[model samples]
Target chain A: MIILEDVHYTYDGIYTALQGISLQVDDGERLAVIGANGAGKTTMIKHMNGLLRPQEGRVILDGQDTKFMSVAEIAREVGLVFQNPDHQLFLDSVKKEVEFGLRNIGFTENEAEQRRQKTLASLGLEGLAERSPFTLSGGERKRVALASVLSTEPRFLALDEPTIGQDAHQKNRLAQMLAEMNKRGRTVVVVTHDIEFVIENFPRTVAMAEGQIIADGSTNMVLSNDEVIERCSLAPPQMTLAARAIRNVFPEVGQRLTLLSELEETIMGILGGA
Target chain B: MALIEFADFSFKYLGADSLALKRIKLIIDEGEYVVLTGPSGCGKTTFCRAINALVPQFHRGYVAGNVYTDGKNTRENEVATFASVAGLVFQNPENQLVTLDVEKEIAFGPENLGVAPAEIRRRVEELIELLDLEELREKHPHEMSGGEQQRVAIAATLALKPKVLVADEPTSNLDPKSAETILEIFAHLNKRGMAVVLVEHRLDLVARDASRIILMNKGRIVADGNPREILAMDLCEEIGVGVPKATQVYKRLRTRGVDLRNVPLTGVELAELVQEATSQ
Candidate 1:
């Protein structure tokens, strides 16, 4: 569980990235931070794992304040998978990258190697053990990054736009992987502008705009509010556009849906002469 | 009226033994949304560069074909003038953007073309509003997100108001929603009659609205059709082109003993199909 209390983050002593961000992410909750390009999403997540300390208030991780914790200590409790895989992955091989974190935390050579193999196999990167990390594609690099974090076995996982720029196949693979990881009871917080991913994957949603938590609730509830969506400079998902059209003509079907996934079924139910 | 025409166009980079493109004959009508896609290094980027004369000029390769743009042969045209009709936004926004501030960045193109100061100012302001970049005007390029920076790069391209805008993996730097906005902007431009070509592997976002889909493979346009038609081909999977969720669902249901060969193209259509099939 994580509790953010009046967290305000400013960089370079001038630009305020996040202002008064307060939220509680319960244990086992898959929370999504939805926003436009620069909606302070990264600033909020950086505070969690001590990448950036809050300039004001407190960021408490399972009752331990982040201010009192070192970044190395934070890494043990929360694994941060950044959008750019190049940042976290420093090893030559896919297998070693996964084991690097384990070895750095002072695990024995055997134990680190054991964790690396297991993590690689579990993520379907078993054959990539001998493969060079540099030779991999964008999607493969991201997977290697996730594999590295998962190997360390952190209690909480935070990702920044994990599916950016990936093809649909890659995106689906990521979605499936994240869903499987979430089902195992790891608290997953993803900061993403990928509306479709949010709609299909995360049941809960939080929208950030101009350094503020503008909306928070179910994915459907938070996304349907056009005022909040526009303020965030974000567009509605494909299904939401269709849902709104149906609502304009017949409000009945619109009331029962929030996500495009749910809307698709609801609309089909209506179209089938329900 | 075709703004760009390719006659059995084939190209191979300098010193390359194999052809990167082969026997490609095509015509892009002005203001059309044509998405060029395939697996990485499959000649998508190579073919895109050919539009703006990068193939033989910047690339210094042997091109054994004719490429005509606006009735002028691409090989014979000046690189600068051909650049005016076709603007290429590269895969990385950070690489494409060369300016410090948002306003100046947008006006960079018009200024380079020697537009009047007042015209440049007007164009920049209009672009800021059009692309919803008002608040970020004074901000530096590095201060923006990957998605914001991509938008800025795109807005700068629009300031030139080129007849054709080709972005090579632009959304590969953005989140899905921002990708959607970018695609929406592409659709808006196509509606306004600006010829557009996007080299993207994310077929789902452009699947519904794109007027034409050209599937490439090893420097060849293997398959060409509308969105649904291209997705329905088994070759799409083999060539590594992604299938939308609807197409995937449709393909799965067919194997699972459901008889919906008519795959829905978009999420909405898929939903409707599922709802109907289940209820019945």
Candidate 2:
């Protein structure tokens, strides 16, 4: 489990990135952090892995205070995938990139090699193991970056904008992959601007705006709140909007209806059949 | 003549195993808004590059057929010659921004084309206001957000005053509101008689505004037609293209015998359809 108590951070001693944030994440939890650009979503997640230590409060990872732990030490339990894959990928081949993190964390050569092979195969990247990471497409490189971090088998996996530049098929695959990882006892945290993806996959959401956590609750409740959605500059998922638009006609249709299947079922219920 | 034409065009990279674009035959006329989309690596980018002769000219590829811009064959013309005819905005705004600040970046294109200083200044000011980049005029491109940089990139491309604006996934990196703002700008530009050909995957945001939808897969134009007609087909779903959420619901309702008068492209439209159906 991870807990942040009244955390505060600033850049260059001028611009405040996080202002008194307090949150907690349990083991095997699936959470999403969402807001507009410059909302400090990235800065908030940077605290999870000790990339940016809080200036005023404390972050507790498992049982230890993160302020006392080095970034390398905290990284053992927290794997952070940056918004841009290029920042994390520097090795030549995809195989080397995945093994680099494992080797640096003190894993033996044999263990690192076995984990690397399994990670690559799991992400459907075994076919491109020998290819240069720079030569792959944006989506493929993102998978490679994920493979690199998943190979570490960290307790908490925090991803920043994992769905950018991906098509529907790729996004679907990533959702499934993240679900599988969570089932295997890995906690997943995603920071993204893709509202539709959040509504579909994430069960819990934290909405932020201007260096503050505006709202935190179940994904459906937070997204359905007009104030939170407007304050965060987030567009609600299409089905939710559709349900709200006809609320006068079908007052039973809830505002929290986000999934297409949910809306279809409601309409079918009203229509009295297929 | 059409603004751009690809006649039985097929292209292969210098050492690639297969064709990047195969036997593409299409014409994009002036004042038309076209949305080109498909799965990743589906020749959509190559098609955009071919519009400005960047494929065979800049990338050094084997060309099988002909591409013409404003009645000039691309093979016989320089890439620079088509700059004013077909302005292409890349997917990554960071890569295409040449100048430090937003104002200079917008002015760089027309200056290179030898436009008069006064004329360039006029176009730059017009684009800045048009793209709502007034406050960001002095900010560096690298310091701005992804949405702001994309607005600047679009303004820079518009400074050249091309007949057709070809953008490759301009809003992929933007937040939802910013993406809608960018697409609205493209629609506004198209309303003013500048044809816009945008490459994007978020059909939910753009399917309503685009006049035509061109679907590509494996280097081929699999489907192309009116947005409503094309989106109603199962081809989009089979090819992994993101059919709008409202459209998906409409199709499901149709299969279950809830027939609506039209294919709704957006949530509001879908709700209107549902209201009408339930009222009857």
Candidate 3:
């Protein structure tokens, strides 16, 4: 479990990224963070892994203060995949890149190799095992970065914009992988601008604006509120918007829908009634 | 004649085994707004690089056919000459930033082409007004957000007064509203008679503004036609290109025996369509 209490952070003591932010995430919870650029989404995620220390408040992990723990020590329990794969990829080959984290966290040579192979295959990166990291495409590089973090098997995984450059197929594959990981008792927290991905996968969402948590609750409620979405500079999923449009005429469809199948069924029912 | 033409073009990297682009044929007329899309590693980037002669000039790839811009062969003309004809904006905003302040960065391209100081100042002011860069005039690229930096990049490329602008995944790093704002800038540019070639995966965002959509797969053109006709086909979803969520809903309703009159691209249109069908 992770707990944050009135956390405040300032870069160079000039720009404040987080302002009195407080939140809690239980073990095995899947959370999604959504906001505009420079809204402190990345800064808050950094505190979870001890990359950035708070200037005023406190961040606790499993009831322990994170101020005394080193980044390397905190990383054993929390793994963060950066938004840009180029910032994290510097190794020669994909195999070495995935194995580096395992070896750093004190895994044996044989065990690290076994886990690396499994993670690579899971992300469909086995074919690029021997290829140079710089030669891969943007989407392939993103998967390799995720595979490296998955090999560590940390209890909490934090990913920044995991669906940025991915297509429909790749996005589906990632959603399934993260769902499986969440089922196995690992917490998954993702920060993204992909509203559709959030509506489909993440049940609990937190929206930030100007360095403060503005809305936090079920994805359906927070995303459907027009005032909250406008104040936060966020555009809801297209399906959700369409559902609202349909409700304008049919008034009977009360709930906010985020899936196309549900929208189809609702429309068919209305047409049949006519 | 088309402003840009690819006649039987094929290219391969210096040491790579297979060709990155194979026997591709395409054209871009004057003032056309075209969107190119496909799966990852499907040669969309390779095709964009061939526009300003970056494939064989900077990347040192082997070329097999002719690429013409304004009736001049890309291989025959100097890369510097084409810099004033075609402006390229890369994926990452940080990679394109070279100057300290936003104003100086916008003037860097025109400075390189030896424009007069007064003319450069005029262009800077014009673009600042057009792109809303006045508030960020003194801010450096490293100090701004991703969206701000991308705006600076676009303004910098526009300072060259290029006739054609080719951007690869410009909105991949931005929020939805910021992405829409950027595409609206492209629409504004297209209205002023500047052709645009955009390589992106989000068809739902750009399909409404684009006159044509070109789909590629494994180094070959799979589909090329009008945006509405291309989007209505089943090949897009089958090949991994995501259609709009509303399009998916419309397609499902059609399969379930709903006779929709027109295909809608935006969510509002889809909603109105459902209301019309039910009210009747």
Candidate 4:
């Protein structure tokens, strides 16, 4: 479990990035943190892996205080993938990049190689194993960065903008991979601007604005709230908007429909009744 | 003549074994808003680079056939010479922004083109107002948010008064709202008669706004047509282009025997169509 108690962080002693943020993530929880740029979503996620220690509060990771742990120490349990893949990827070969994380965390050479190969194949990066990370396309590089982090097999995985450069197909594959990771008892926390991905994948969501948590609950509930959606600069899923628009004709239809299947069922029901 | 034309174009990066873009023959006329889309590594970025002659001129790639911008063959002219004909906005705003502040960044293009100092100032001011970057005029572009920096980059690109603006996934780094804002700017610019060629994956947001949709995959132009017609195709979904959610819903409803006419691109349009279909 990860717990943040009234965490406050200020950058350069002036810009308050996080303001008294309090949250908790149970083991195996899938949580998404969303907001506009400069909303401090990244800052809050950095606390999970001790990348940024709160100035005024405490972050507890599995009953241990994160303040006492170095980034390398906390990384054993919590792996963080930065928003910019270039920031974390410095190795030559894609295979070596994944192995580096495993080796650094004290994994034996043979064990690291095993995990590295498995991680690469899982992310569909086996073909690019021998290629340089720098030469890959943006989406490919993102997966390489992810493979590097996933190779370590951390208990908690925090991804910052994992869906940014990915297309629908890559995004679908990533969603499936994250689900598999979560099922294996890894807690997943994602900070992203991709609301559609959030609605389709994550169950719980936290909406932030101006360095504070404005709303936190089920993804459907939080995304349906007009105030939160507007304040966070989030574009609601298209189906939700369409459901709301046709509410007068089919008042029983739920406006929180985020998936095509849900909307299809509602429309079919309405057509049958009509 | 077309604003941009590619004739049997195929290109391979200097050391790459296979072609990045294969036999892409297309014409983009003036004032057209074309949204190029496909899965990652589908050569959408390469297509955008070809418009501005970056593929062969700057990247030093093996090129076959011709790309003409503003009726001038790209192979014949310098990359700098095409700056005024086709402006390319890169994916990452940080890379394109060279000046310390927004005002200078906007002015850099016109200045490099040897435009008069007075004319450059006028263009900068006009672009600042046009892109709603007035508040950020004096601020450093690197210090601003991704959206703000992109706006500056677009403004700088516009300062050159290019006939067509080619943005390579300009909104990839932006939040949804900011992404919408950037697309809106492109739409607005297109309305003012400047051709806009945008490479994007978020087809749901742009399908309604674009005049034409070009879908690419495996270095080939798989589909190209009106947004409504192209997005309604199964190939769009099969090839990994994100068909608009509303369109997806419409298709699902159609599969279930819901009779609907005309593919809807937006939520409001879809709602109206459903209402019309069920009312009868």
Candidate 5:
């Protein structure tokens, strides 16, 4: 769905945000880009959506270089959700915000409204149709931002920090929502710094630092190793550390569990016949 | 005397019908680490600004009752007086930053107050080393990353040597490692006899570090207690606030009828508790 080959992006022709980046994400794949602040995660997402073009290399969406595509054309192929939802949401009403993009693409009023209803209902935002988008809370802003994107029905959805400022329940809901989106055969890429979210949700993890890709592979391998996770400025999950801290007590239990669910299962197994 | 005291204080922002905070009475002991949190619009940030007299002084609204900071009444004390008493690091580092360069930014607060040049030099040097920002000292704000900028913002505020450090959502935008560094910095400051008031949602991160936890809602403090006691309450999870991983494990075990007394708040604590549980 997305490919980056020696992609180099420099903002204003002087400052390089991404340096010679090479990454490929297949359809229906859930890939997480994990890094600290200014690690080029946002830069990478902007390239994927063709918002920023590489000065040196190429960013290809389905084998087509973004250098030739229009913003409207790229918007159809890839939906980008910004970190701050308020910055993207401009319209007064929630329904109107979702339909804004569709209307821009020259959809009929009836078609746009139909698309809005479907997208909101799918994201469980149906009842909030008439409410003012500005009056919504932070989490609601996040969902509405996503609703606006989902209304366009793009093939690949790239979200930058979908779970920021969210509560525990909202975090889980976002996790489940992303999982469901991936299961529905939509390519999903998330840029996040939360280690727990990366460990539990992403099947494949890509680590970046100082405008470069450092590590990319199965989520378990990328996040389990202390050196890699630490170098990327992420700590091991709490359960992984807890399991490691008390490994001596349970000789049979491994300290390799990354998720809480894995630790719970291991604990139950150690307790015998759960 | 309490560094900050609020007795039945309530406030309504300009153009708002309902009170943002209601009947709020909180006394923060000097040098205490208080973790204030609740839902997104729960008025935790409003309460933090009350210490710096931002609520009634700068922000338009109706403020009721009494608020005292460092023996000075909030209503009467000029915001400038609280300026040295309290330093605020807002959530967005980008939005809070005023200067272009890191060193200049760090020196901004003291400059605003017209502190002596020699003291400013000492403070700038102290905070540079304190926040490990020596490498980025001369870098432009736009040149640095978000985490680095956040550190600069805090370092700038810390240079003022405020008696109270009120950080609003300090780590919400940072990565885990950066967030850890931030919390560690807060802990170090709190240890230096500075009252650190952290308004955040991630109670789990500072579960052990906080001297007390005060959960706010609808402009009112709904729950106030020690970390262990307040986190054990079910209200925390329902409202989207988090407890430590250890507390979460204990809550799960308790739901399954397992009597896990005194669950620790960190991974190390959980390890000891598990050992004790297995041995018995």
Candidate 6:
């Protein structure tokens, strides 16, 4: 659905954030981009949604070069949710905030309202529909920002740290929402430092370091690589660590288990028979 | 001494209908490490603000009860007076930062208090080594990474030498390793006899370090106990707080009538427990 061919990006004509980056994201593929701060994760996502054009090389979305497409035109296909909610939220009320993006995309007032309600309801923000967004908490504001993008119904969705202030239940809800979106054949890309969230949800993973892609493979393959995780300043999720420790005692147990349910099942297979 | 005390306190924000905090009675002692957690808008932030007098003073809310910090009445003391008693590290490090360079930012707090240059130097040097921010000391605050900026914010807060540190979701924006480092720093500070009140939603990373866990919901304290006690209850999952992954596995095993020896909180502990059980 999206392809970045040897793309390079720089800020202020001096600081380079992406260097010779190349990757192909297939249609309806759920991928996670993981990295430390300044690893070009955010810069890379901006390229996907036409927020920033690469200084060198091409960012092609749906077989069209992004440089040739207007941001509004590209936004119809790719919706980008920034890391900070405050940067994106400007409207006073929650209902209006979600409606703004849909309205911008030339949706009728009736259609925009329908999407606004459905998107807010999907993220559990229906109760706060009338409240001022500024009065909401950090987590609530994050949901509103996400709703604004989801209301646009873009074919390719890119989220930067979508689970920043969310609690466990809220995180689970978001994961489920993303899964539903993926099921509907929309391409999803998440840029995050949230290793656990990625391990549990995203199937494909790419790790970046110092403005370049260092590792790209299955989520388990990339996250279990201690060297890559160390280079990215990320800690493996507790489930992976626990699975490794179990593997030490019982070598039959695998080392790549990333979810608690998977680890539990493995432990039961080994111990429950006893 | 009790570092902070709230007695039947309730507050309504200016122009708001409902009270943000309601009938909260709590006490945090000197040198205690407490983790306050809840779903968003559950009044955890309001409680943190109450500790440093940001509740009624700066926030301008209607108060119904007393809040005392460092044995001083919150209403009687100025927010500036709480500086040496309680220091706040907000969620966003960029929002809290003021000075240009890391060194100057760390020194900004102490300098404002008229601390001697030699004393400021000593404090700044101590925090730099404590946070391992020596490499970032000369870098501009705006130029550093999110982790580095948060570390600088911590160093700046430590420069105040407050008896209590109230950090509101300090690691929410950081990566796992950086988040662990922040918690380790808090644990170290707690050992030095500083009362630490951390408000965080990511309990899996910070739970073990806290001696006490105070769970709030809807402007009220719903649960208060040690880490093990709190995680053992079903309330953790009910309240949307994440119990440790190890704990979840243990809980699942116990539910299946497995005779687990201990409720392990970490991966190593869970592995060892499983090994012991299987061997038996």
For candidate 2, the docking band is medium
DockQ of each: 0.16, 0.54, 0.69, 0.74, 0.46, 0.74
lDDT winner between candidates 2 and 6: 6
TM-score of 1: 0.75
Model 3 alpha-carbon drift over 4 Å, by segment: B276-280
Candidate 3 chain B least-lDDT 10 residues:
B11-20
> How much lDDT does each candidate structure score?
0.78, 0.87, 0.87, 0.88, 0.82, 0.88
Over A1-274, each residue of candidate 6 has an lDDT whose tens digit, in order, gives 7999999998998888999999999999999999887899999999998899989999998888888899989988999999999999998899899988888889999999988888788787778888889877788999999999987868899999999888887888888888898899988999988878888789999999988999999997888898998988888788888988989878877646877899889888878765
User: In model 2, what are the clashing residue pairs, if there are any?
Assistant: none
lDDT, residue B276, model 5? 72
Q: Write model 5 residue lDDT over A173-211, tens digit each, in one string.
A: 667767777788888899987777777788899999889
DockQ-better candidate, 1 vs 3? 3
Q: What is the lDDT of residue B107 in candidate 4?
A: 85
The 10-residue segment of model 2 chain A with minimum total lDDT is A265-274
Give lDDT tens digits, candidate 3, residues B125-199. 999999999989878788898888999999999999988999999988888888889999999999989999999
Candidate 5 residue B267 C-alpha distance from true site, Å: 1.9
In order of appearance, the predictions have TM-scores of: 0.75, 0.93, 0.96, 0.96, 0.90, 0.96
Clash number for model 1?
Answer: 1
TM-score of chain A of each: 0.89, 0.93, 0.96, 0.95, 0.91, 0.95
lDDT of candidate 4 over B15-59, digit per residue (tens): 565788999999999999999999877788788888887878887
Going through the candidates in order, the fraction of native interface contacts each one reproduces equals 0.19, 0.59, 0.71, 0.78, 0.54, 0.80
* CAPRI tier for the interface of model 4: medium
Model 3, span A1-274: residue lDDT tens: 9998999999988988999999998999999998888999999999999998889899999999999898988999999999999999989899999999999888999999999998888777777888777777787899899999988879999999998778787788789889999999999999998888898899999999889999999988888878767865677677777888888777889686777888888888888898
Instruction: Assess the local accuracy of residue A271 in candidate 5 as a C-alpha lDDT between 0 and 100.
Output: 47
Q: For model 1, how does the per-residue alpha-carbon lDDT over B22-126 read when each residue is reduced to its tens digit? A: 988999988788988876546777788788888778877778988887777889887777767888887578878888999889888889889899988898888
